[model samples]
Target: MKELAGQTALVTGGTAGIGLESARLLARHGATVIITGRSQQRGEAAVAELGAGVRFVAADLADLESVQALVRHCGDQVDIVVNNAASFPGALTVEQDVTSFESTFDTNVRGAYFLVAALAPAMLRRGHGSIVNVTSMVAFKGVPGASSYSASKAALESLTRSWAAEFGPHGVRVNSVAPGPTATAGVTAEWGDVNDELGRALPLGRTAQAAEIAEAVLFLASPRSSFVTGSTLHADGGGVAA
Candidate 1:
């Protein structure tokens, strides 16, 4: 039997990169996966690529109304949630605009918060569910141009612990996965060779792949991690340790 048979998973920002890979893995394990993205076109393409057992939902995590609508659409069928949607505006603190900072927080922190707030009650009632937040190594180690992004992820990590404590007792587990420099299309496009450069500096000597990070998400989302909660699994090529 598949590990996630009969489960339903919702992966935010799942049109591409780590989010898309995570959705693929969950569906491969027999979960009905719902992937969300701001573009209906991309979402539909992703669903088509992933084939059966995966569907797409249109959502903009930076918008509260969209987030709420997404929650309503999912209703109470979500057995797993992957908070993978985030906005990465890389700018020095002095150079960072207010709009960029707010947008980062709105998508990364506020969106995840409300999603959990709305979905957790159902998990509590059912007495079993998992939430895996896709954080970043910047939350643990400072990065030159990631002030807002880092802070947002740090906030999510803190919430992971709090949610774990609040929901763990009720049989719902919450945790986080922090990835270092990864060679995703967006990251590669934005950072160019910087990701590879950073990866070489890490203890593992290479940047991570989207699929590698998705594997970590799969572990936390499945019963394989039944006893794990409130902890951060660093899939960062040992960047945090280095």
Candidate 2:
């Protein structure tokens, strides 16, 4: 049987980038994948691209009500939840405002926080589940223009450990995947030709692809990682190592 033959998964911010790829992989493994995004057009497009049996739900993580609505809409008993929704507003500490910090935390930390709260109990009832949070390498390293983004991700990493501890005894696992400079549309738009410049600086001499980061998320969300919990997988092409 396929590893996720009878499972259901919720992947937030899944219309593009790593979230989209992760949802694609999960669905390919026979999981019923439900993806959430803020854009109706993009969500529908992603569902179509992922083929049959995959669903799309509109959600904006910055709104607590939307997050709650998403949970209620997804019904009961999701075997996997990927907290891949996040906002990245880059600003130096001196220039960062309350709005920046709150917005980032609202989406990255608060949304993921309440999501685990909402879905974990049902998972506990089933005595098995997996939660994978997509964080960033800046959470572990200092990035000049991304203070708020980094802090928000750091909070998520901290929650990964806390949730793992709280949910482990109940047979549910919580973990995180931190991606380094990855080749995605968003990144390419922000940092033009970053692969060659940043790639040379990294230990592995290259940036990562969105699919590679998705693979890391897949591992944590699968039974293959049954014994793993409270861990953070760095899919940075050795950026963290360097």
Candidate 3:
């Protein structure tokens, strides 16, 4: 039997990159995976790629109303929720008359927070579940030119601990995965020339593959990790250790 047999999972930001990989891993482990993407087109494409027993939903994290709708649409108690959709609105962007902080927090932190809030009640009633926030090494070591985004991840990390404590007695676990620079399309563009600098400094000497991080997520989300909660798994290629 698959590790995740007889489970149902929801993965946010599942249209691309790490989220896509994580969702696929869960599906392969025998979970019915429902993935979310901002664009309907991309969501449909992602569902197609995931094959049978996999599905998609469209939810733009920046919008609270959309998030609520997405949760309601999620249907039934979910065994796992991978909060993997987030944005890195690099340097100096602003939202709602404030600064980039608002935009960054809205999508990265608030979206995940509210979605979990909506889902947790149902999960708790079911008496078993897991929540995995797709955080970044930036949450701890910090990343330049992405202060707002990093701050958002840091905030989510805090929530992971808090949620773990609050929900543990109910048999729900909340944890995080902080990945280093993975070779995603977005990261490929962000790398330019400085990417190698981090790799050289890292003990592993190279960025992790998306599937590597996805496997870590699967571990944390599985019964295999039932005793582990509130921890941040660093899939950072030793970036922080270096």
> lDDT per residue, candidate 3, 1-242, as tens digits?
99888889999889889999999999998999989887899889888898998988888888999999988888675889999988775563333235556877898998999999988988888889999999998788855666777888999999999999999999999999999878777676755545556656678888778889999999999998989999999999987786
lDDT of 1 by residue, 22-131 (tens): 99999999999999999999999999999999989899999999999999999999999999999997788989999989999999999999999999999999999999
| Per-residue accuracy of model 2 over 161-203 as CA lDDT, tens digit each | 9999999999999999999888887667755664456667788
C-alpha TM-score for every candidate: 0.98, 0.96, 0.93
Give the least accurate 10-residue stretch of model 3, judged by summed lDDT: 91-100
Residue 98 lDDT, candidate 1, scale 0-100? 96
Where model 1 places Cα greater than 4 Å from the true spot, the runs are none
Least accurate 10 contiguous residues by lDDT in model 2? 190-199
Return the candidate ranking by lDDT, descending: 1, 2, 3
The 0-to-1 C-alpha lDDT of every candidate, in the order given, reads: 0.95, 0.91, 0.86
Q: Which candidate would rank higher by TM-score, 2 or 3? A: 2
**Native-referenced Cα lDDT, model 2:** 0.91
The number of clashing residue pairs in each candidate reads 0, 0, 0
Best by lDDT: 1
Q: Candidate 3 at 94: error in angstroms? A: 12
Write the number of the candidate with greater TM-score, choosing between 1 and 3. 1
Q: Could you tell me how far off, in angstroms, the CA of residue 135 lies in candidate 2 after the best superposition?
A: 0.7
